[model samples]
Target: MSVNRRSILRTTAQLATLTAAGGLLTGCGQEAATGGGAAASEHPAHPSPTPGAPTVLTPNRIPAATPSAAVSGAPSAESAGASPSAPEQPPLAANTPAEVISGPSDRPQVALTFHGQGDPRLATALLTAAEQHGAKVTVLVVGSWLDQQPQMARRILDGGHELGNHTLNHLDISSLSADQAYAEIAGCADRIKALTGSIGRWFRPSAAQFATARVKAQARKAGYEHCLSYGLDPRDYADPGAEVIQRRMLGSIKPGSIVALHMGHQGTVDALPAVLEALQQRGLSAVTASQLCS
Candidate 1:
């Protein structure tokens, strides 16, 4: 089932209320992060598999860099001490695909993506669990959130996971004007580049589950090749019971599914062990979105 704009806005409001009441229990970060949704096309384009069988492309590997070093042209040190200049980044490739809904269906692999904004402790816990289970995930971080916890960018990359952009303030890009959308995309990308020495590996629209074509173009101009969208959403943002979250994910996942999850929700953190276990039991491995797409 697709999540419409109205429901997404309502959920955002509910999350805000819960946070203000201190009733929302999130994983180990400073505060609870919220989510937004958008209506999606019934049949968005997906990566095509090879004839007769899915082509298993080797995952692209970018060596993790030191936290002190910048990925782009930003200054290397944010401290008072003298530091070495960061290396310049190579120009990004052009003609990247505008969107990717899922990886090749022939592989027994799924990508788990977390929308980040909430508790760093919880985010660390999730990353640790994924590593323990021989899995990697993609974290789409909000730009403003990164500004609050700049270290998270390095922490995520340090764990062998990939990072992506989720806009500046997590507002719905579809409703914004073209220039506003570009600002959101560029703002987040700037943060990612400043912290990681490169723009994010992907761009997922904020406040909306799927990116509009206009937003996609903006993201492309900002340096992201693919506008990432999920094929499986367990609605972890709703704070369903841990068991429910686990069951829904374990029951719904399929080959090449990109599972959308959230950061800062205790239920999601609690449910992840079982979900990872179930994936392993089924001979499916959890991978980063970039890996799945690659």
Candidate 2:
């Protein structure tokens, strides 16, 4: 077909594909710097898959950030109110060097990391499924999500899953200025620390799979020793069928690999069992990013 028509068809397909996510998705996302939707300067080899939220928590949760509160580049949310007591955490990631991508190739373990937002019920379902299969995953939550669903912070930890920060508003962190980026990182981190007795362990940049140097620096300032990235991406946030998610994961995942998934979709919840089963078949245990990296 003509180039114009092809472009139109592609756009239409993307729109059609997104229809099912109506009001369901909150958003999150990567593998390398290479391929999905982010600007080339943002991620080079693997483009990010889920590219908004950039927040799907909607405008209802809270202001993406309080501009004034964020100006000092300090976390203001910690003093908001009393937070729940957190459960004992899993073995934390002590490695302070390099980006956390995958684990040692010789080990039979892989990490499943989720961009956490969307319906709490769905998030719970996915977590339950993972736990049932004797798996543990990492959840990098958007700050605003916790504002709306504060209880989830404790619930995630209670389930033996490792919780991390995915920024306060889930914005395109790579595109933000230093102060703004710091606010995003520290903002959510403060919330995590307040709710869970710690800022969790890792920081995964929202809207992008990889963290830019600036983002890494900002995360360090916010108390993260290691930034988390992923080696495998099934694009579960795209609302692709559970089979597609399962197929993509089974086909691409490897030992010591970190797989990126999302918490807001039903397809992801449905795909959990089969994905876990496939991993079991391959003798790979699903673990947290800290577990894999450390």
Candidate 3:
């Protein structure tokens, strides 16, 4: 799961050169989920299961211009836009990975992240634990949730953790049209920008669902490199009990890990203290997703 700096530099150089050439290089790249090409020409494929862990899946590599055939419903915000007079949400600022602050690597470091609609109680618990432990955790807020819970969103920003965009209404990006997908992403960026006066740089598509090269390209164009998870995830989203959540997280966490847990889950909240304590005992310093990307 660890990609050395030389490899990262090489890939980054290639990506940068490609960007200068126009957009991303057009070609078919295999989807990790099905171990098959996710090109528009191929049929839709499911994400492949991680070795020895049903909950964890392999990381996806973004491809250029390879259109995916996936489909899904429209974002909730667009539907709400039936009234043109609706106030526009603030725009998100651009976040390029080159700007991120790198953290300690000689010592173990992991970023604990929460996904989904932000809940007040869950946010309180997450922020409180992080503050009490001096841990820096990344919170990927849904645009609708942020607009609904502005006060909570403000608290998250005030606390000094990096805020990332998690698309409006949690629609799967693979299912939306290119324009629709860009809107879903850009809308959130705009709203977040309106709130914090900065565009969002890190974007995590709902369900890690980037089915087409176009989807990934759209995200990059919006000033984000699709955030990829480093640590294998345990499915806390399904409401797996607290013990199970803790057990799964503790089982696979390692250095440079991007551990994922869901927000709005009571069980995860309950398990968090134990998880944080374990992280402390193991000397894994917590950080934001942005910090890890660089």
Candidate 4:
């Protein structure tokens, strides 16, 4: 359940092999900045500029000065001129503005977000439990995880949960080149569409580590509404005791807040019953991430 720092590094090397073979690596995150298992080497320390590469900032949004030559590689024509072969896309399909759908008055209505590597039974158990409460949770389905457990993903959809893109590999977007970042997100989106005929709306930066403005801009360019965390760090990756998980979640209850949990932990499953019971007591209902946005 808990991968050590050394184990994480070893796993990352294995992941690189999969990537080289054109396989997707999803759901492999390590806590670095916020105990979310964000590996320092996983993402590049500085941003690279590649013309035609997707970037969070642009001349329209930021200053007109061109990105440095070193950061920006050879400019692709698309960066300067439009191509006739390019397909037109809807605004929302590519980039939607971020929103917090708070209602007129305060009530316990919020979305729960989970982060972790893949486990088939864990996904199924979470879906079944959520369905029992008639609640919807948003799952940031990673490409690697999906490739390994497509059946489980179908179950998430069947149970009425929303699927969001968690990236091809769980690399920190802040550390990847603009084009690499685009490929990570776009590749995942492509896989999801091929499998489910649905496009993702929400994107949670790996480990919720949004260190660079460019990464955020790149997300917008890639057509994802950025998902920022609000409260209830259940720290499921750490394998907290069920009692401790329940207490932290109960203490952090708030309307319109997004609770962070992991899909790989049995402790999370063990704590869910109590969490659900408490939510019912407080007159709250968990909705999918998209529903919360709506």
Q: Pick the candidate with the highest TM-score.
A: 2
lDDT by residue (tens digit), candidate 3, 200-258 = 45677765623357667777766675544344577776677889989998998877677
Off by over 4 Å in 3: 1-107, 116-118, 209-211
* lDDT (Cα, tens digit) per residue for candidate 1, span 1-294: 357988999899999998966733332322211111121212232111111221211112112222222223222225312222332322333533567777778989899998876777888888888888999898988766665567777778778888888875565467777666776677667667666667766889865678888988888777777898888888777777799999888888899899988877778888998899999999999988767766
Provide the TM-score for each candidate, comma-separated: 0.70, 0.72, 0.63, 0.64
Better of 1 and 2 by TM-score: 2
lDDT per residue for candidate 2 within 112-144, as digits (tens), equals: 988877778998999999999999998988766
Pairing residues by index, what is the TM-score of model 1?
0.70
lDDT of each: 0.68, 0.71, 0.57, 0.56
Q: Between candidates 2 and 3, which one is better according to lDDT?
A: 2
| Global local distance difference test of model 2 | 0.71
Candidate 4 stretches with Cα past 4 Å from truth are: 1-105, 209-211
How many clashes does each candidate structure show, in the order listed?
Answer: 6, 12, 17, 14
Error of 4 at 189 (Å): 1.0
Q: In candidate 3, how many Å is residue 243 off?
A: 1.2
Candidates 3 and 4 compared: the better one by TM-score is 4
Model with the higher lDDT, candidate 2 or 4? 2
